[model samples]
Target: MKTHPAAHEPGHSSAPLTGFSQCHLGILSQLQAFEELPALQAAAAQAQTIATHTLALFHDAVYEHHADEERELFPAVLRSARRGEEADFAEAMVRRLTAEHRHIEALWKKLEPAVKAVAKARPVELDLGAVEELVRNYAAHARFEEEHFLPLAETVLRRNGNHMEALGLSLHLRHTPQPIGHI
Candidate 1:
């Protein structure tokens, strides 16, 4: 239930590139912590505290980051690609990235309950193999986005001008929390 600093910030108006870079750093740190879990020998309360923080980081930040790409940026990229030499290239990349998202989500599902148990200070067996796989998968995912998807996005969005801003705005709106009474 902790608030993330990046949570309600206006993403499009702000620097999306910097935001993504920061997000990637945060995710890498959290994944490092996750990787360390198997080796941790803390008391129940300490373990629970660590797990709770990890869960919050994933839920609040990492997931939102993913949504920004999937919901806003990816669509913009597709539209921008509709009439370029990069058209087919963009399509293929988006498909690969989307599939990677699914793989990442599936890995999280396998990992969540064990993390939840740790959060509650309950004894639970974690799948170490799954943990290793998730860590490796995320590392690869980050690299792919940073090296491939991002450069392409920058090129396409740059040509489209305001599309980048629109993407930023969409990301900002998506992260902004809705009032409880709002429809």
Candidate 2:
């Protein structure tokens, strides 16, 4: 797939979100796999392998993605909007999206213990419902961001002083060899 020319640079032409978009694909696929896990299996070494990797992904990529959006992307978006109505609109979108993130995280928390047990090659009563819910909600959240928020962000950032460069710089600095997601 030919990515956007700026995909290699943080925040350049939605590069931050471009990477996020890819992560979303992985997350969804993993969630689907989790949904299909043999719930009653006594011992499945392969399940343990998948579970370990899934736990790593949730802890690393998904958590960092939330922090980046909350600390960087959403704020940059709010800054990119004009005062009054535009700002209000951006705030509403951010609120909804942030809420979705929290809800997804909550769903993950519910599933974490069971997944952890599976990771250790132990029997687990994995809540397939929770896994399915996470998959469903996350899918909707990603779709909304891709379909609505990203385009709106690009337009607003481009319109308001061409702030994409500043956002890019901010994101690049955040990911440099340092404590990430630290104030």
Off by more than 4 A, model 1: 1-46, 82-84, 178-183
Q: List the residue pairs that clash in candidate 2.
A: none
Expressed as tens digits, the lDDT of each residue in 33-69 for candidate 1 is 9987766755566778878987997888778778778
Q: Evaluated with TM-score, which candidate comes out highest?
A: 2
* RMSD (Å) per prediction: 26.2, 26.6
lDDT of 2 by residue, 66-167 (tens): 999999999999987889988898899999999998999999998999999989877779988888999999999999999989988998888856488888
Give the least accurate 10-residue stretch of model 2, judged by summed lDDT.
36-45
lDDT of each: 0.85, 0.88
Off by over 4 Å in 2: 1-43, 160-162, 179-183
Return the top candidate by lDDT. 2
Clashes counted in candidate 2 amount to: 0
